[model samples]
Target: EDFVGHRNGAEEFVIITTLSFGPPLHDALTRRLTEELHSFYNFMERDQGYVLIEDGSGKQSQKPLMSAHITVSQGEPDPNAQPSKAASTSDDPWVDASEDQDQKPDSSKPSGSAFDW
Candidate 1:
């Protein structure tokens, strides 16, 4: 056997094989090489032994997996700027994109509250 699957930049879909079989044909050749490498990479058979593929274009190809589970996020930032003294303090109040739009919200201090984590 030789199977090899991909998709992994969070899209997740790893598979890698190299079978031979012996112990009573190793559980039917590892379940027929994980169902022929999930139908040669088309994937889509989730339940207990998960499997779901959809790399329409999001990008993902770095390989390396005996098993994996990923979930990452850290996107939004730049609502005008200035929130990174490690991420807060230092007179927070940003949003002055060169000021002068009927200026307000700086009533002397007290502004760090946008769902401040």
Candidate 2:
């Protein structure tokens, strides 16, 4: 996996590579992963808040398992930006509708069909 950090136009990359197998490859891979995470964490800590821009996975040459990329940018989000109309007007019942009082359970469908036997 590769995690790239961008701050004020500067870019830093951290790559983690691991071989397949259970206990035989565990320690080294874990150590490397931990080191890379700490390095990225320190970089982000120095740069402050960052927003994730992209994430994807694909085949890589060095390792048998597929590789992944995660990109983060230090650019600040627009504070004055308005929500999209489609998003604001969304009628989907599940999203942010926990407090809604108008919804009622349907009585027409049997409640326990799986237990009917």
Candidate 3:
């Protein structure tokens, strides 16, 4: 299916491309989150019965779906877990193009496949 292919392509691109670092990485993440949120809102708008609770005070209010999900916190990593191979190997998380040339089938084309976002 087209969706599966595109998802695989995205995963491949992330694994092979060095944009995993710095601003480009954050920007890509932001865009993905925004798209997901848009989809969630569209889904919520279609169903009239679904209501999200805004607070612990047991108040029944029609608040935007985003308000109920706005608070985010980073999860602490497990201290006992072993470091991944990539993390253990180098200080830089960016993947070197030379490290795995065969990961990409077409060297002439841009690393990430064409995407509107």
Candidate 4:
């Protein structure tokens, strides 16, 4: 459901994504999600940057959504660096709740699509 465009007969192309959510998230979660979305959108909308919102409207069609035009500079790759994973973040209530229960994971069992955290 994603499509990228190549324009001006150049090697550079713009990336377009279609993000979907199966269910509506609560307002408490919206702030974090919206901030992350803006961060990602801004990164992609930088100099040599391109942005287009062909169909951005969604559950909140009445509200206006902002488009970004940012300039990003790529930094040299770090071999020892690691990317942050949301599931491992401190903000995850699920992880905290599970920790409170103090139940260790059953490593012997195979994981499935609808397994617990």
Candidate 5:
């Protein structure tokens, strides 16, 4: 995913990778995979995302378990930004950096992550 950021010029663009996972989620094994999804792919706020479960034939059935639209930005979201009535902040899986940060200037924490589920 590539998009112009808050930067003044269109020349300044952010490029992030997106990965679509299909089939079998939220279960114990799937939870581990989800962590790897965060560890390996490393999706950011600007990135697009998708999740669908595969059928017995190993093909996606066109149903989404998660989506980029649901994963709110970790960066400064617009004050007016609000989740739709059907979706609340609690439903979002992405954790904000602010919640886990330490007061020290050099607090030990990863600079990037897809986010913890």
Candidate 6:
């Protein structure tokens, strides 16, 4: 049996599929298709911004597998938009204190719990 699904958006579509076969063949087929799908996704994400692969080979070692492809388009930002302001010195102190707090949990609270929780 075969199954397919997809989602829609302004610039792209995603398609996924699954196929079934006997246990031995299914395992092998699934493994191969899964590897191919991973490679395909990497290529699409890096090169084409899309993915396309066939799903399922009914070999005795194959299992169920899913495949997908996509297309992406780059959009330009507004030229007239104002650039964001740089953070002031006050903001820097808050950021530094936040990092210090993260490194050291509050000793006033019990070891496992937070003050609010």
TM-score of each: 0.17, 0.21, 0.27, 0.18, 0.18, 0.21
Write candidate 1's Cα lDDT for 1-117 as tens digits.
533333211223333333332343456656775665555333333233443323569764433212323322334447898764442323333323343243444344435521111
Whole-model Cα lDDT per candidate? 0.38, 0.38, 0.43, 0.41, 0.36, 0.41
List candidate 1 segments past 4 Å from native.
Answer: 1-22, 25-27, 43-61, 64-117
**Candidate 4, 3-108: lDDT as tens digits:** 4453321223443443332122233345664575456445546432445534445332222233323322334559898996766424443333324543544455
Per-residue CA lDDT of model 3 for 1-117, tens digit only, reads: 111112222323222223224356456766786676556555656355344645568876764443211222234559999987555324443445456333444455554433211
Q: Which tens-of-lDDT digit does each residue in 1-117 have in candidate 6?
A: 432322111112222233223344456666786676555345535355433433466433322223533333334569999998766544543333323433444466545422121
Q: Which whole-number lDDT from 0 to 100 does residue 33 have in model 6?
A: 60
Clashing pairs in 2: none
Pairs of residues clashing in candidate 5: 23-53, 23-54
Best by TM-score: 3
- C-alpha lDDT of candidate 1 relative to the true structure: 0.38
Candidate 2 lDDT, tens digit per residue, 79-107? 99998655332363333234445444445
RMSD of 5: 17.9
- Estimate candidate 2's alpha-carbon lDDT, on a 0 to 1 scale: 0.38
Candidate 3, clashing residue pairs?
Answer: none
TM-score of decoy 6? 0.21
Error at 68, model 5, angstroms: 17
- Candidate 5 residues lying further than 4 Å off, grouped into runs, are 1-26, 45-47, 50-117
Please state the error at residue 87 of candidate 6 in Å.
75
Candidate 3: which stretches are off by over 4 Å? 1-20, 43-60, 67-117
lDDT of 1 at 22: 34
Question: Count of backbone clashes for each model?
Answer: 0, 0, 0, 1, 2, 17
Model 2 stretches astray by more than 4 angstroms? 1-64, 87-117
